[model samples]
Target: MDKLLKILSENSAYTTAQLALMLNEPEDYIKAQIKEYEDSGVIRGYQAMVNWDSVPDAGVMAIIELKVTPQKEKGFDEIAEKVMMFDEVSSVYLMAGGYDLALVVKGDTIQDVSAFVAKKLSALEGIVSTATHFMLKRYKEGSVALVDVEEPTDGREMIV
Candidate 1:
């Protein structure tokens, strides 16, 4: 990955001036690079990773693995694009294992997700099977720790 992209991925809030200073480049250069990235679809979008567990009633997230028959001419792209159109879907990816596609879906409850899988996703053409896994908790996301775990206090004296 490019240094600029790596820094942006770690923290997108860095201003052009700050990024230029860190990269030892001019602000105009940094700005132009970022603009080119966006124009070329290299940088899709910026987002803040939220710790939903800390918020009450933040709803549920499910990882749905799908087995499908890829169209002769279109392959997986057709079905993947159709799946991406659903509002409940947040992320979708093509996999190389038992499943053809994996989707990250959000709903108000487990039942809601189940219904979506049964009624919407499974009903689509070429969809052979699906396995939905509900996320009970999220300890980390986007390489950032969402929870702090403290060491047990067993009253042991420090050796150092």
Candidate 2:
């Protein structure tokens, strides 16, 4: 399991033969395990990681911090249901400390986004308050490998 997991996580597109070589297992045996896992719904499917930044008209993104009145009995389940109703919401998470729910959403424009906020999310029952912060810039995003940050120097060059 450890060997299989490492290979899967590091480079998911590796072939069965490549994985067999890495794990020091026979190709047929490794293939059988993969098949079994897929059959039982453990291994899902292969995917191509596209760098979607190259695409135009990608739209605006924002992170909305939501404070909601959780149902005394049902907890956050009810608020979560209302959040899912809005198509603009890409993802929602139950957060810690400051807010109850945090939404990562995308919209064509700021007005379109604020409309969703006014019509659907803010008006939803049990919603106490909301604070939205538009994502102005993304130096890095998604599963893109993070780069190392180096020490900064003074802008002016010292004369020798």
Residue-pair clashes, model 1 = 0
On lDDT, the leading prediction is 1
User: In model 2, which range of ten residues has the least summed lDDT?
Assistant: 142-151
Q: Please report, in order, the local distance difference test score of every candidate based on alpha carbons.
A: 0.94, 0.80
TM-score of each: 0.91, 0.70
lDDT, model 1 = 0.94
Deviation in angstroms for 75 in model 2?
0.6
Angstrom error at residue 61, model 1: 0.5
How many clashing residue pairs, candidate 2?
A: 0
Candidate 2, overall lDDT? 0.80
Runs in model 2 deviating more than 4 A are 1-3, 26-52, 143-160
